[model samples]
Target: MNATRIGAGDRPRLYVSTTDTTDVTGDLDYIAIEHAINGEPVSLTTAEKVYTAQLLDSRGLTPTAIGRLIGSDPVTIRGWKTNGWQPAPTGRPHKASEAGRERAA
Candidate 1:
């Protein structure tokens, strides 16, 4: 699909809601995709995966196809779709961390 320009205000925005892989994949290089596939740093992996899934989904790719691209299972991809592909929380701050911050302030 083509990008649509919205808003009648001074600053009109170009919104792309496409089913074309080229429109999505063209902006990403091989190295960036490789980094996401590697699941490095641990913390950002979930977000990376979810974001990639959303991009591929917008490009008219199937869950199975997205899973294949990202080295994940189709079931997991389906779950992402069910839950809106939101990344889970990584972890919580340490106990007393808020108190410590207040004291510092």
Candidate 2:
């Protein structure tokens, strides 16, 4: 027997199979449940900050080159060149104490 399991959104499907010729003593055909284990979301702000940092570190690339590579605005790149930015916080949140952000600078 063959079984297929679907997941939410654009997640990948899971497949399983069993046969009497195979290990029949165990669970036969099983429909494995699929879910977003350790689900997390990306922050576009963080992505922009990371991309800007990478562009700054590339050394050889001009603003236009970096913008084309990342499909962003050259004006944005120019702004980043002047006013640095930080990546947006990920969905995971923690207390300031837990994150060690409360310590004296």
Candidate 3:
């Protein structure tokens, strides 16, 4: 089993892996069994809530106004603005940029 953390600055990501095939397969099988036995509901995190709020407020207001209302920094709100000022639908929607679409293709 191996676990690694990678990222820079305040944003960091975690990656976990197992070299042993049996261990990996067992882990996945266990996860599937657990989910089947006891299903769990998905919930939103604080950051997601904040982003949603900001997006909602921006619908009828400027980015600065939305940022102020949601207690988010202007720069972060600006980045979200560049991605199209549309509220995300229920569940995760594809909010891809031009470059992202190109790369995906």
Best by TM-score: 1
**TM-score of structure candidate 2:** 0.31
**What lDDT does candidate 3 reach at residue 1?**
94
What is candidate 1's lDDT per residue for 14-87, written digit by digit as tens?
A: 22233432234455343444444333222224555676777778868888877766767878878888887864
Candidate 2 runs further than 4 Å off: 1-53, 86-105
What ranges in model 3 sit over 4 Å off? Answer: 1-58, 84-105
Model 3, span 1-105: residue lDDT tens: 975543224533211222332233342332222222222122333344244444354446655654544455666666655656433345855566966988989
TM, every model: 0.43, 0.31, 0.28
The runs of at least 3 residues in candidate 1 whose Cα sits more than 4 Å from the true structure, single-residue gaps closed, are: 1-31, 34-44, 88-105
lDDT of 1 at 61: 84
- The backbone clash count of each candidate, in order, is 0, 1, 0
TM-score of 1: 0.43
Order the candidate numbers by TM-score, best to worst.
1, 2, 3
Task: Encode model 2's per-residue lDDT on 1-105: one tens digit a residue.
Answer: 965633346654422233332224432212211111112222233344344335343546666665554455767666655655433345878777866765654
lDDT of 2 at 60: 66
| CA shift of 63, model 2, Å | 0.7
Error of 2 at 86 (Å): 4.4
Question: Which of candidates 2 and 3 reaches a greater TM-score?
Answer: 2
> What lDDT would each prediction earn against the true structure?
0.59, 0.42, 0.42
